[model samples]
Target: MMNIKETIIFAPETFNLAETTRSIEVAKECSHVFHCIFMGYSKKYSYLIEESNFTFIHLEPHLSDKQITQIMNVDQMNGIKHPFTYEHIKERVQNEKRLIKIYQPVSIVIGTTLSMFISSRVCNTPLVYIKPLAYTRPYFEEGYLPSPFTSMNLLAATIKKLFISIALRITYKPKSFTKVAKEENVSLPKYTIDALDADYNLITTTPEISQVYNLPDHYQYIGPVYAKLDVPIPKFFDHLPTDQPIIYFAMGSSGSPNIIVKLLHILSELKVTVVCPMKRMIKSQLHKLSFNENIILCDFLPAHKISKFIDLSIIHGGEGTVQTACLTGKPFLGFGLQQEQRVNINQCVRFGNALSFRKKDFTKARMEQLINHALSTRTIKEKALEIQQVLKDINGPENAAKFLIKHFTVT
Candidate 1:
């Protein structure tokens, strides 16, 4: 008699690159013991799932391009605006519940899929969330706040926290989701942090750098789960000279194109060679501006593959990008576009592996100054390399898979 494999549904918000890729990487590890099925509403990144040879189920109420853009902005914490409509949420919930009933999987692992939070509960299926440590409750309650750079006194900081607490209550509990959850007899989340809660919240950062006091057992601190994109080496890399220092500018999916353009012009004046992977985001800008012989622009570069050749990385501190920098042993200069990114960057700054600046201070001169410092400084490079040695040994994907197996064993 042949043994049947257990099913595990991996639902990721397909509109974002990091979220989609992270799910794929983790699902790859889980494939040995389970039949992994990828599901999402956006076709924007369906190709990534198909390329990995995973079975993808297209969900209904698909997200439009404009909605995806709106989501990106909301993710960046620009405002409280969202794209979830009553009809859309209703249809999504019904579809999610139907899929859950059909699969009856061990657990549903997700990456920022808001609908899964409700449907998983309705079906009584366990939900595992893959996210950065900053989103966890202990990180906030353990007083990772009153940041070092803040000039505010204790009273001011208290007021700020109070305001944020109120905001969380209002924004985290969206009307559509709350209404849907209540209709399905699911308990509504009281605070914003509750929205991110799952049966097993896999915090994707090393414990050493997470800086959260007294972490709970339910929240596992799996080391960085970064993407190892299967992309070919850029053609320009072959012809490039090895004498000059090479700087990697990776703003990631949410980085501002205007800032990238300005930074490129400044880099043009420097003696270093720049490898920038941003053709898709700045194609029009590229046509408008004259290229510097030292600057090479490509649609994408396998960051993990090229880290050895680069001297420094400049990035908009997305969690995945920061982890990739650490995993590859590259010292970086980070400019965070939002609160979550700021937390990720600040943790690296504390480790002395990177330098960061606020948006107000992110001028051309500051960018140049930091790049020069990171390139010349031996300590930053050494620290990054040290973290690299530690991270490479963790085997985050395998560990995460094991954690799931431990909780939900296949019999």
Candidate 2:
């Protein structure tokens, strides 16, 4: 087998530590040169680089933005692209080219939106899209269609309009940054179609639960790559109360803190264990909130381990988090923080495995109602359990590793 140098470019702050670390570990097994890029701050994922398990090279993150907030809001799919934002695109394009030249990367794996767009514009690098950065499904996939003309019925049309509106965000660029590429160089993709133009599109979701259909030959649905957290169990879980229902909740990076705090208060009062893994920034605010013995807070907790005790989960509609909920045989209530989450929520609800709510539609009573519904509903629980078996049987990480290795071996 011939081993070539491979550079894995991840979007800063979006790609979690476990997925990146495991991919690096797997790539090393085949003797590929593994290089990574990260920027800003990631207290949760930074430990992978600091604690060495292999020879992974650290590369600079692409920080080319005309305005920091503008780029973030745009990159986050919360903002529209500025027609006059030529300099910013050029810098990003130049930065990507520079990194490609420096590392001499053969295969580029993207896990976020901006990186996906960057890879689309890259000249020769083969892109391996790991997960959905946008809510694009296979063209023939059955369910709510995004196109205005395709909706055959009134309900379908209504849903299509709703999802489409949510997909388009009005982002504001807060501050500008240093330019790495020239103003005259790069042109950004205007649509999801242009952004996803890659050599390989690897989906981590299973076909059984997905609305996506008619995948092309280059695309692969390998199942869920659930994060493997080494963090110890929280002390609250030391004693088990099997009688009452328990729920694991995460607001994710994009979730609103005020909403989470409000929900926590309600969950605490419901006489059930609410296991919430919070980011450190939210740690202080949690002190102000009241909690009963059933409310447990931690900096980190393994979802797989913790899900054993949880009856349901509440998440900000991330794919990885959804996979965790599904693979653990627990239903997750998707509280969408962004537009893309609505895509996942639609699919999960369509398949009858999970419940969902848009943030705008959220109220304390609605949240409580959804929680109670998921817990009491047996059909969804059964479907969740069934999906769990399918996900386990698929062995997402191993199969994904194999797929990555095969690309290296063949080419």
TM-score of each: 0.93, 0.77
Tens digit of per-residue lDDT, candidate 2, span 184-279: 233443444544446677777776677556677878877776566656777667686888887888865555567777777777767577777774
- True lDDT of residue 382, candidate 2: 84
Best-fitting candidate, scored by lDDT: 1
Error of 2 at 363 (Å): 4.7
Q: What lDDT would candidate 1 get against the real structure?
A: 0.82
Per-residue lDDT tens digits for candidate 1, residues 1-411, read: 987778899998887788888888888897887889999999878888999999999999989978887887887876667789777888999999999888889899998898899899999999999888775567766635426425478876777687556645654567888888889999856777866789888888886787675778778888888777888987777777788878888888777788788778878877789989988888767668886799888877788888767888888878889988888787898888887888899888888899987666556677678887887799988999887887778877787888887777766
lDDT of 1 at 4: 78
Q: Can you list the residue pairs that collide in candidate 2? A: 67-175, 67-176, 68-175, 69-173, 69-174, 70-173, 70-174, 79-171, 91-181, 204-223
lDDT of 2: 0.60
